[model samples]
Target: MGGKVLVFGGLRGSAEPRPVPLGDLVVLDPATLEVERVVSGGGGPALSHHGSVPLHDRWLLVVGGWDGRRRLSALHAYDLAGAGGWARLEEEEGGGSRAPHAGLSGHTCTKVSDREGGVRTQRRFASLDTLHVDAAARRYWRNPPNPGRSDEPKGNGRGLIERLSSLIASGSASPRTPRALRHHSMTLVGPFAVLDGGECFNKASDTVCNDLFIYDTRTAGGRWYQLSGTDSEMKRVGHRVLVVGENLCLIGGRGPDGTSCSPEIYTLEINT
Candidate 1:
């Protein structure tokens, strides 16, 4: 919201997707094109596919993502007003700080409520009340009108392989849940979170998918609708999507052909 841009952990630039974890907190001056290191400790969370959102006037919250070997569930807060550094969210439990969920990466968390404030993280929709999420895989069930957070126990929620293993064990052998995506962007649109094109490796098909979907935050029934509009035929990944007035502007991304990057810019006129 200021002149400076706050950059969190992300993968190194590459044409093809590779696991390159970067945990540096950087501040960039758009006008001057200067860079500054914000995290001075050991380092920021060395993670990729993580999602960050502005917490308060002076803070930004970095949530779930991959940490090289495994997915991480630790909640980290970066101080923007004070000396910029990373700090984990500690809750008083038995005179000690207990850890939060550490099972997801490549997830998205958005501030859905202002009066009863909370951050909604995805992979599977879960409601945890204490500003701390414990049950990493609460599944997308019908929640109440008013969301109440859950205080489940600490556990490594199921990953893609694990879930698939379970389905195979049960003889169902079907892909039920949506695949995890990387290099994606989600923009808050009124009561909806508009998620545009990103890269997702479909283990079932062994192919990459570049699709768009939208989630309505106000609904008790957690549901996502696939969005297909103008230029939706063009498969795009790692692109920039922004809400401009009544239209959603989609900028450059990896083209569907996979040989080159997309140079064309397109926008979908929001009917609402």
Candidate 2:
């Protein structure tokens, strides 16, 4: 993630009516923009509209997405170091489960820490299912059955739930959790998970929001504080947001009407 760039399954844009699904995992040189290597997505299926995040800056964790016709339940990881390739990480909770990710697309995955009230964790909500975790599991891809030193936590790829439990155990999480949301923007700012607008997970009303919510990862239960104001009323979806200094820079994204809004960068002033 820091040195090289990774590309996973997507569609072939040149396809007629719609892009055809692809399953190749491509690694590229960040500077030269040249292809480093391409390989089959290990035993994973071709996917698009999925959520991906870097784990330890060495592996790419890929979770739920459309496998062409239907929503996929598999989770995959691409190793960026050594001779690692793609590896499908799964768990046998309750004997069998597919939607362990709760729909990963449009969700946000964050790396946080609640250790000794210091920090070190990851979590997911909605479509985001944090994967690609742990530096010790670098060799996991080479052999799935025999992960050797890969512990049960990292091996099962449950970084999200595991870290969330740890955070709650730290007695810093809020007692309540936010409702399921998709296409929302959630970023970390000083141990706090700040969330912005996204459509309701229900999709029945397709309600896009323009409010702000903050979760103090240092507290129990997933409690959040919602910020309301007159100026923070621009309904957003498919947008991107990041913390810049003391402000939040909202980037290009379509609005509720499903049309691209004006070419403007919105800023939200945040005090701590």
Candidate 3:
């Protein structure tokens, strides 16, 4: 969140769709673009295509990504100001922790506020909770809904979404959790977390969307608005939406063709 440039393990010069994931944490000099320090084991659970956000100013919250084999629901935290390395957040299970909800990959986790709450419904239990990252204690708790649930074909209790969408970026037939985006981009603007251009998880969930979908962070319970009837001719993914004054600008990103990266920039007008 500060002026620090933090990087986790990611794919580099690989042709395979699901290449071996990396788990190293590195900090870079913001001015010189040079490596400052590298923590070998700070990057928890070899991950790629994950979502992350800064906590306070010395911690990073990484959630839900592909771990070389399958999608992971684990949320790992790293302490930048200390030397404790990585920590896995979970519930009490034989003195170990576990995932709290169905796993997600290529999804985005937006930071609304330090304190927020939401309601969740599971196969058995309906829980009311929120995300809690304790920077002072250097620990993360699964105050989120649906404790100890998994759907990655890892044989968890009553797993959901048995088949992976054909649109998954990995180009595999692996089973994944519901709403697992392939490689979308999401950004926070004003009061909404605007989601744009991502691979569709399944036919039942959503189709390949290039249009704008806004989620009101004011309430994490239930409120998703889609701006349909946009220019369907241009399909974008892995793109970014920037708020330029009263207008939102769409920046450069590879088109749906997966080859040509558009050089033009366009602004979007939302009727909100």
Candidate 4:
């Protein structure tokens, strides 16, 4: 919420197959363009494509991803306002057999709250596919229980609902959300979330996409609509996107060639 940016697990390299998944947690000062801190205490090996959700003002919950060798469904919590360390999120109230499902990677999870002072999670993305050829899946989970802190959201590692489709069309004329989006980046802006570039398997789509799509969660039936009128169609993968006031800023990623790195950056002005 301040001038800081939090970065979690990701891969570091220009080529594919195995690009060195990273497990370090990093915080950066965007204004100075410098890294302020780095912590490496998460409960697992190095990972990439993990989803993280802010639990509240006090903590952040890091969820499933691929840990280099295998897809991981491990959960870890990081204390932002207190002693900085990682605590593994167990499956049961008193801890039980087998951890929470770890087969989720390349997914998107956002923090959502209700008027009754309860917070839950909303997630949508393709499951972990080394080839990026799986169908996009939507899922939701209720907060577990009270976590001692009045403001902390509890998660018991159960109650996951799968909504197979989120690509509902508003009308036959309305453009549907882009398909074959696995490695995309999404930024929450108010009631809408904007999804940017990502890659698909060469056999499935044979290309990376630079298209932009918007998901509206304000109404009864939420759907994804393709955003039009952008002159720059820059295909990319493994990119980062963030909201700066009313504008959306896109940073570095692999370019159209798939293997080449893109040094150029672009910004899209949002009228909303």
Candidate 5:
């Protein structure tokens, strides 16, 4: 079942803030060129730079975002089954509190399907994979590699590794730390998550990366790789990375200097 594509509350830096915390929800019907807005209601305070996911039966799960004054971690749900209105979801303990945690830009949340008689079915589903920038914490958190199910080598080392081993042996799981990422884009490709170009905050040179990294969820290991692209283009942030077939389409985003980059699209072929 397909629904509308609605975008709200993202703007170039210099542009005046949209009069409201949440911008108009732009709705587009997939089968036609028709587009319109449905007023969203009761979703707490207005929010920008937030993360939204379409839940079962046309409900939207709205998470943390910046609301001008401060960052928010309050969870709200919007029902799209009829007249849309927002409802709150209780947050897990130690989860991002009311802090601006990267505002969900460039992250991906995928609905996991259940299997029945060897066929995949999209029933009422929940996200098994979630990626976030966690700007406030300055790191990334992924679902912990399933213990007793993962095949990654439990290596031995003198310092941090040994401490980690002790923690695991005592049945204490490591709390997921946010990764060191800023202005990066992540998309799920099969069992792997691919991260694309964005600046890495380096105090020495303040370098921005045009590099690529792939995190294998199954293996719980990540490796960095470089991409071949022209340097004339400005460094991008808050861009949309959409998976269309086997190609990853890099769509519009703002540059490092807070200027909106000219509308440009790049497609990267994934080697499956």
Candidate 6:
């Protein structure tokens, strides 16, 4: 319920209780509300009320949901190019199972260009890396952290002689392990991917955040800053967000009370 909702295939009726979550794929045209059945592979377990997003070209990436009884961490990609069928990607090795990952249902998953050319460039594909956004942890662990930073040296200026000795003898280096984060929302701002608005659950309920983060492939050092200037809303959970050009459109979602489908829309402008 706290994931993304993809408008593909076509809009169908409200999901009804059925055996093995309905495998039917319905996408809302946004123009017309007509329900159309996009080709779903053979008789696989019916998938309904799950998170889906457009991947590369004509491919949809689906992850996590209740399959009636148990929650799923299975990562399946549906290729919409030919006669679309489901292909399961290998699960993350040490990463524990993920469920109800935010920004999945009713949320938006965008394909961002890692390079300046576009998404189709080979350079972009070479930089194609998976970012695991742990909503509960409030951090992002890039599969391969920035190589340049990961191999940098660290430590305060100590004895100059000792520092020089250590640098030469041991090749002074500081490796930063990938981190896990929670409560953050990940979206694409033009060619850059932005991770914003989440709290680090360290301090006792006092560390809620409204900070904005930007990761650009061209830049060696990423950028992070608090969203100032305007009277912005508090960081919220269960809110659905979609990227339309340089603007991010946030829609109805659960507040402090509970889950809501009210017709409220908020737009955030980004320079991209």
TM-score winner among the candidates?
Answer: 4
Where is model 4 poorest over a 10-residue stretch in terms of lDDT? Answer: 156-165
lDDT of 5 at 53: 49
Q: Which stretches of candidate 4 lie over 4 Å from their true place?
A: 14-17, 41-45, 93-102, 114-174, 201-206, 228-233, 261-266
lDDT string for model 3 (1-272, tens) is: 34546767655435676568778877755446577878776336778767777665566777778788887766777877746577776543332235446666655665545443111211112123345555545444444443221111122211111111111223332222224445666655544445677666565633555755554434445345555435764567545454433445675455656435565567664332
Best-to-worst order by lDDT is 4, 2, 3, 1, 5, 6
Global lDDT of each model? Answer: 0.53, 0.54, 0.53, 0.55, 0.44, 0.39
TM-score between candidate 5 and the true structure: 0.57
In terms of lDDT, model 3 sits at 0.53
Backbone clashes, each candidate: 6, 15, 0, 4, 4, 22
Top candidate by lDDT: 4
Give all TM-scores, in the order shown: 0.58, 0.52, 0.56, 0.68, 0.57, 0.47
lDDT of 5 at 37: 58
- Runs in model 3 lying further than 4 Å from the true structure: 26-43, 82-84, 92-100, 115-129, 135-139, 143-182, 201-210, 216-255, 258-272
Pairwise lDDT winner, candidates 5 and 6: 5
Estimate, for each residue in 31-98, the C-alpha lDDT of model 1 and write its tens digit: 46577545534555787667666644456677767887787766777667645566676443552224
Query: Can you give the lDDT of residue 105 in candidate 3?
Result: 65
Instruction: Name the lDDT of candidate 6.
Output: 0.39
Candidate 1's TM-score reads 0.58
- Between which residue pairs do clashes occur in model 4? 72-102, 73-102, 144-154, 144-155
lDDT of 2 by residue, 69-180 (tens): 7766455677767887777765433422233344445545554322111111122343222232333442211111111111122222243334434544564343455576
Candidate 1, superposed: residue stretches over 4 Å from native: 3-5, 14-19, 28-42, 94-102, 124-184, 199-211, 216-226, 229-272
What is the C-alpha lDDT profile of model 6 across 47-165, one tens digit per residue? 43344445433555555554666545444665555665666655344554343332222222334332211111111112223444432222323343223211111222123224323
Write one digit per residue (lDDT tens) for candidate 5, span 1-272.
13445444554345665423554455644335366655644544476555554444365555566666665655565555555565565433453333433333333344332110011111112122332322222233333222222112123112322332343345443233223555566654444445565555543453444445544344445333333334535456656565443345676566555355545566654331
